[model samples]
Target: MHHRGFDDSCGLECVENGHDSNKFSLLCSGSAVTYASFSSQNESKAKLASSAAPDSGATKGGSATKIAWEDTFEVAMQRARTEKKPIMIDFYTDWCGVCKQMDADVFPKKDVITESDKWVSIKINAEKRPDVAGAYGVTGYPTIVFAEGTGKPLSVIPGYSPSTEFVGLMREARAKWKPEAAA
Candidate 1:
């Protein structure tokens, strides 16, 4: 994988491959060479955008409504337990294109935000929180797991989904979740 337009500060050279035109390789200042998939390139772009403008909710079209992400999984779990709402855990990696797409396109939509308000929405970096990711059996990027406050999973959605489809999935999770079952 090769990516273009990395900041000059990093002094990274983007090299295009003949075999896989979609993929690219990044040569750092030193002898280190890193290969990135097409999807990973998108993720890198998203990360750059996020870090460049920390307060800007910049999207493809314009500014987007940001979701109020919880600080930690434990905090979200406690809030869910207290509010009697199911926990919506987003398992994602920084280098996932689909995850970046969801953040930029699907998650900021009005329908998604409104539907998600009923649950304790939490976003976890799978790489950072390997323990939680391992416990939930999350093997893919952009995995949405709906679980009870007690951390029992009711539904798991893998991959990127449109806003309408995502809302339907949320409804199904809500319908299947039983607060009393957590006891």
Candidate 2:
């Protein structure tokens, strides 16, 4: 007979040799085992930790704002055109689990936010902006669209991605659609 032991916090099992009829035994297991670890307020926390104090002269909510964008499509379009930056439109719904996960896991990462600053980022509520979502054919939550120039679609990324992959996606978009000088 063979025996195995593990600490209280660890998750491990003991198994007899292949010759034995019974395959294995779970000797010890962890109290909590989650596939994903993140929270909705993660973005706000990350921005607060990474961004500096807002300057008195700073316009609008300043750099510390999470999901930095305006609700108005016209304003977003104007910013994209005048800033000569690529537009990144995020299609999301408040009730979506995956969308919340994206906000918690992906958007909070320093690299994702930093790289996103180069583009004219916008967030469109799938429910409130159903026309925009329909126009872009966004059939899923957390759909990300990289638009080149004014109102020109370049690429669409659908679904929730981890921080590293999300950063890579943004980098790829930047490479494919270089930003023009700000007006």
Candidate 3:
């Protein structure tokens, strides 16, 4: 199968030739947006590779955020339990434009990254993890579910949320597990 992508900046796009267990990606202008096959198993490494790119965004003190997203639900749940934080699971699909947009625009922003620290962040390919997605009752692309450390969902952001709005949502969802908020 052949996939096509349209970026407002770069109209030239491809979703990768055919499909493979491994993903295919292209770096537009060396640092713009990444056009690739997004999968849970490899996106972590992709994050590492992209961290050094020009548009990768930086945290406070200029440290590059590297590999912060958990690749799977099970790992994210474990981290949520260990850190005593809520879980933010991003259920996305390869063909979802909003999902790719969020990956390129929202998830890498400094504010979103900072707010994400309050929860255990994860990226789940809904097509790859239909069981998990179905269990969460996710019927849309880019269904971001904020759940307790125990994995009970508290709230959801069902579609594309820009960085500014996304940060607020993250703050609200994360607050659910806070001691003061819980009390």
| Candidate closest to the true structure, highest lDDT | 1
Residues 17-100 of candidate 2 have per-residue lDDT tens digits of: 344423332232422111122232343234324533212231222254444655567787888788788878888776555566
lDDT of 3 by residue, 1-183 (tens): 744454444332334546553343443343322333346424533443443222222232223463267766887787777767788888877655546667777777888777777777778888889999999988776688988878788897776566787888888876666633221
Q: Tell me, what's the RMSD of every candidate?
A: 8.5, 12.3, 11.6
Better of 1 and 2 by lDDT: 1
Highest-scoring model, TM-score = 1
lDDT of 1 by residue, 156-179 (tens): 887656788789999999999998
Ranking by lDDT: 1, 3, 2
Using TM-score as the yardstick, the better of models 1 and 3 is 1
Which residue pairs collide, candidate 2?
none
TM-score, every prediction:
0.65, 0.63, 0.63
* Model 2 spans with C-alpha error above 4 angstroms: 1-65, 178-183
lDDT of 3: 0.64
Model 3 misplaced stretches (Cα beyond 4 Å): 1-67, 178-183
The model with the greater TM-score, 1 or 2, is 1
